[model samples]
Target chain A: MIAADLAPGAVLSLECPTITRTALALYAGASGDHNPVHIDIDACRAVGIDDVFAHGMLSMAYLGRLLTDSFPQQSVRSFEVRFTAITPVNASPTCHATVTDVEDGHAHLDLSVQLPDGTETLRGRAVVSLP
Target chain B: MPVDRSIIGSRTPAFSTVAERGRLRFFAQATGQTDPVYTDVAAAAEAGHPDLPVPPTFLFCLEMDNPARGSFLSDLGIDVRTILHGGQSFRYHAPAYAGETLTFWTEVADVQSKKGGALELIVRDTHVERDGAEIATLTGTIVVRDPRAGR
Candidate 1:
């Protein structure tokens, strides 16, 4: 949707499957982040973590997909996220965005990634240019 | 040990990568992005993009192409096991597409200690450029926890 068509408070959402160890392993290979905490259960325990968790980038990537799917790629001018909490293994996450502002040819969105329990693990915003 | 504050402002040697379509497709699929514009040239062209558009946040992955990617943490004597992904941000000046060669230059932007030096935060900013023109700026933070703090 174009910025002109977006109204403040309009929302877009996407539900992602449970984050699996295999997915994290694939992302490790794809993204070149070999951090074992994201893929190795033992490594997580060694580091004082209860278990391996999803990479923060992986959730950010989901938020990216939410934006690209709603608007054209060239229209996105900025995307940002702050990792707030650990996304545990096998947790299904949902990404949500609300049109916080639309003006000067830009649609500003407040973005978030939340676990099934409604705990927000990632939060941020994006600015998409109008076509 | 906390990361050395003196490392702030240190810059990494510039590096470049050709945005290949295959890699873009792999990233799109890996992230569960079903958008055709990210994987199909025609679909991207139909959407007004010159070519397959680089997915947002993928620039963070590209920054990893720097051969000295891990040296920053190593230089601080921090073990990889103790690090946590803290946060990340990207600002786009222009859209990047597949097959374009983009250059990246990164600098350590900030460093701070928290919880009585039990944790450290390192922030880095990377400038993404193409043909001498700016494309995007990526900023990321990594948090390192001191395992011996409580002991």
Candidate 2:
């Protein structure tokens, strides 16, 4: 979609599947970030965390999905996120983005990932160029 | 154990890796990115990309290819068990695609203490390039808790 065609406050959303232990393990292998806190429940307990949690990058990846699914990858000029909270196992998360501004063929979006209860796990923004 | 601020300017040797198609596909699937441009070259071409485009944030994963990836923490006397991913950011100058050999260079950007020295934060910036042309910059912050602080 062209930036000029996007309206300010236009929001796009994606419902992510429930995070599972198997998925975490898969991400561990795929991303080569074998942080035990994301895959080993026993290790998580030892570290004073309640249970194995999703990788913050995983949440960022979900937000990336929201952008790539909408704009072509090449059009994405910048994407960034800050990990705000832990996404617990089995948490059903969703990604949302609102078109905040469009200027000179560039569209800016405010993005976030949150649990069903509205607990935000990640917050971010992206700038995309319209083709 | 407090992190020594002296290592803030340290840099790791540069490394390079080819963005293999299979690996890109696996990452897209793992991240639940259903975009075909990330997994199919033809689809990517149809979408105005030269080839399967590397998804954002995936560069952070590629930066891990550095042979000394784990040495930074060990050299700082940090235990891997006590660390958490604090934050991450990326700036893209150009799109990276599958089959491209991308080089990465990383340097420790900053260090700080929180909670009366119980938690230490280390920030690093990685530069990515293809054939000497800049592709992206990855910024990451890792937080480590001193076990001696006893929570």
Candidate 3:
């Protein structure tokens, strides 16, 4: 567990489970985001997309896990993400956080989630209080 | 139809909701959160929280508690089917716990047309509060793709 003393260039990562349609369905129910394009195959076809894709929030959740895995829950001052691309069903997403600056008991991080196909699905930043 | 830039300064009526434990647990498990602090009240207290601390980005879900959530788009004559999640950001002022009634008020912060009006972006800023105290601020972007553009 990295409890501060982290340099500006410190890097932390989390390998999320291979996202599945079942997971997406559960996430929709749990998060209450029932957008059919995320879970319904027909909706995807109507939009010229072949299959349902993972929710952008799901990948953001994984990035949260990465921070919680290293720092205390309270230490997480803030987290935010941009939905860059869709994480299609069955795609494996890896979350990465690189510390860009450390100051006054906080560390600012550059965050991202990427698939193996070289697609960066989500990009974001976070601020964590240092111990 | 292009988004009305006049809607940029509009604010949604405030709405509130409680972070029920059962749903919090469900969300934790669904997101593969290994930390028990999000589900186990005792563990959370030990971690210096009065109760289960709301997970990161969970407030975005809570924002949907705005029963008029879809009304914003409808009022602007935008079809819900033409939208996509563009992006989101959050800044926490304090840790919110399960069972606390959190209030949300959102403002349409910005509106933009891109790709020669083929796509429109609506940016929203939501203030998360509890007992009139700031809990967090969630900013999200919704992209509206013009179904007929460039066709």
Separate DockQ for every predicted complex: 0.72, 0.67, 0.68
**Every prediction's TM-score for the first chain?**
0.96, 0.95, 0.93
| Per-residue C-alpha lDDT of model 3 across residues B34-82, encoded as one tens digit per residue | 7889999999888889988888879999997688787887888876667
Better of 1 and 3 by lDDT: 3
Q: Please identify which of the two predictions, 2 or 3, would achieve the higher lDDT against the true structure.
A: 3
Cα deviation in Å at residue B56, candidate 3?
0.8
Best by lDDT: 3
Query: Between candidates 1 and 2, which one is better according to DockQ?
Result: 1
For model 2 the local lDDT of residue B50 reads 81
Q: Could you tell me the fnat of model 2?
A: 0.76
Q: C-alpha displacement of B48 in model 1, angstroms?
A: 3.0
Give per-residue CA lDDT, model 1, range A1-131, as digits (tens). 65556999999999987789888988888887888888888876776767888889999999988888888767788898889988988899999999999889889999999988889999999999887
Candidate 3 chain B, poorest ten consecutive residues by summed lDDT: B142-151
Which scores higher on TM-score, 2 or 3? Answer: 3
Model 3 residue A90 distance off true place after TM-score fit, in angstroms: 1.0
Q: Model 3, A1-131: lDDT tens per residue?
A: 56545887888999999899889999998998888878899976776667788889999999998988888767888888888887899999999999999889888899999999889999989999987
Give the residue spans of candidate 3 off by over 4 A.
A3-5, B147-151
lDDT-sorted candidate list, best first? 3, 1, 2
User: Which residue pairs overlap in candidate 1's backbone?
Assistant: none
Candidate 2 structure quality by residue, lDDT tens digits, B55-117: 888898888767788887787777777887888988899888888999999999999998887
Residues A23-59, model 2: lDDT tens digits:
8988888887887888998976775766888888988
Off by over 4 Å in 1: B147-151
